[model samples]
Target: MAGFPAPQTPRGFGSGKTGMRTRTTRFGRTVVALMLREMASRYGRSPGGYVWAVMEPLGMILLLSIGFSLVMRSPALGNSFLLFYATGFLPFNLYQRLANTVGTSLPFSRNLLTYPAVSWFDAISARFVLNTMTQLLVSYVLMVGILVVIDSPVVLSFGPILFAFACAALLGLGVGLVNAVLFGLVPVWQPIYRILNRPLFLASGIILIYESMPPLAQDILWWNPLLHITGRAHEGFFAMYTPQYVVNAYPIGWGLVLTALGLLLLRRHHARILQNS
Candidate 1:
């Protein structure tokens, strides 16, 4: 046994190869394995499975639309409160869920990191791909169902809608990268971070449009990339609300900076994380 290869950690997963092709193959398989594991543990094992995804957000949207419609007699945006809230709520929810999923991915999969086949990159990448894909699908199906059922009088722009979803993914992934390291290193920061960010939904432009907000609030929230994403989504769906506030490059830039910094930290501290955990 000692003279043998000492039991490799599974070749397809990771073999510590130096060539680009080998490294790519290794990482690709690792990601797939992680994704499959994630799917099984999350959606596959649950009873409601994927339906739960669409239902939770759908319920909130209906309650808000109906409850507020009774009070204000109409939504702040379009005639259909469902469309207005869905347009904003879905994207914000996507960003929020992606951030939370990515943020805690390290701690959630810490045990997997002990294997030579699994890298820190693999862990985060798998979570990002899985969650982003899941959220995008949920948003699309839910939005289409609402639009078809209600048949609202709105001209949907495909380009802006796609762009908004992409931005939400990037912004969430960026924040998640940073939070992954923070939560892993500190452990105690999770709840504090949650508490601090608890008001994010209120500030993420879910309940109101950007144009309807106070000028000072607008200036302050202008820096929040999520606001830009939600604003862009509404711009895509609502024909009347063509928001001029979104600076196309801001979210991308912030996302890049944060993701780069977070990757750098993980590249440095990943080994220590596994050791400690």
Candidate 2:
């Protein structure tokens, strides 16, 4: 006891209330910092920071419209195919981008785990949030551009659009999370993703309506949740379109199931999987 001195408090540990506040602030800062780091690494070096986010979907729309318009004899989708395609493409692209990117996030961020805040979920969530926001912004820009160029009487409806986006994000989140974990576990999952994502373009209601199909085919495609989401999204844009466009409880249920399973799997095996990698 002759020469001992009191220990000083660490930077972030203080009185209980102050410590809690400090932790909360640190957590928020970490998330935002990670998000910005990701956004910059992914898109900042390009000439425009976020314009490519809008351009990507817009370019796809233009190429698809032009190619389809040339091949098809008549515009079967009426005078508003631009609006129609925009509605479908936006959500579908969002789902695809999120799923594809998230699948690689775990493996990609393995090194970043040296930092305490950079958990697997944090990495996945950052990518998901960025892609989802970009999709929404791109969707709005595409809608305005369509209205201007095509002169289609674009109807604005928030309810179904919101629902459509929510479902799409949930669906994408579930699929992406599961896929991310799987890819981390099994190398073969990569090739499988490549093959599986290809069919969604045709299988989803992006290019064709289920109603346009024969009764038997329509019945079959109704099993796909992407179709239901896209169909419901279109209904929001076109008043003539109805909720009955397609029906599939599978996507909604499957989405929840997959997301829960993903969380469980990640919680149990994330550290081991990454450590082994």
Candidate 3:
């Protein structure tokens, strides 16, 4: 016993804390590796790479600004159509893109799932983290550019703006988790989900303010959690506007419920999904 290394604890038979730490480190590395792989595969191959990410939204905002400026004297909330649409479009776009990516996490990483180290949650998290950070950076750059170029008289309220981002991310993650399960389990669900989602752009207060809508439309659109998110976003950008229709609990409640449901379903069915894949 003097010279021999104290009976080396067999790998994975170590103390509880050591085991936990090993697992944690492993999970973190797995997630990071997956993130890097995605970045290379998704954006690295494209021409102009990440520039397209910012330009796509910027182009859309510019087109909207030019077209709207022709028909209307000013935006509904502010003098600059660029700022108004950017505020509404950016957060909504973040949710849409994030949800779409998160929804496909399982199938996208199906091949890797065969490995013991790669779990379904890890796949979802990698996509979520990568896309979320990319979108946030794009938003920041565009927002700063708009403020610099447009000279819009606007007050920046970080509280509501951050709240909007949080809600968008939560909703995206929650709905995405559910979609990932459904999309993987039921192939037909993808098309139907797309059809249902198409109306969200118009309905989410991106093109129309909540107050300006008819009473009947207001009553119905109020149920859309995204409408509340856009309203909250507008509140942060426009000092004069305060949307009473936005209920803080509505979006948060939907996000929490859907996230819980999605996680439960994924846990129950992930093995079957992997097998089928």
Give per-residue CA lDDT, model 2, range 197-268, as digits (tens).
898898888888878778897878888888888877887877766767655465678779978988899888
lDDT of 3 by residue, 1-277 (tens): 7888676766656687788998899999999999999999888976688999999999989988898899998889988899999999999999999889999898889889889999998999999999999999999999999999987567889989999999999999999999988887898999999999999999999888999899999999999999999999999999999999899999999999999999999999988876655
* Index of the highest-lDDT prediction: 3
In model 2, how large is the Cα lDDT of residue 275?
Answer: 68
Worst 10 residues of 2 by lDDT: 73-82
Candidate 1 lDDT over 20-98, as tens digits, reads: 6778999999999999998988888775888997898899999988888888877777788888889888878877888
Better of 2 and 3 by TM-score: 3
Q: State the lDDT at 74 in candidate 1.
A: 72
Winner on TM-score between 1 and 2 is: 1
Write the candidate numbers in order of decreasing lDDT. Answer: 3, 1, 2
Q: Scored by CA lDDT, what does every candidate get?
A: 0.84, 0.78, 0.91
Candidate 3 Cα deviation (angstroms), residue 27 = 0.9
What's each prediction's TM-score? 0.89, 0.86, 0.93
lDDT-wise, the better of 1 and 2 is 1
For model 1, give the 10-residue run with minimal summed lDDT: 11-20
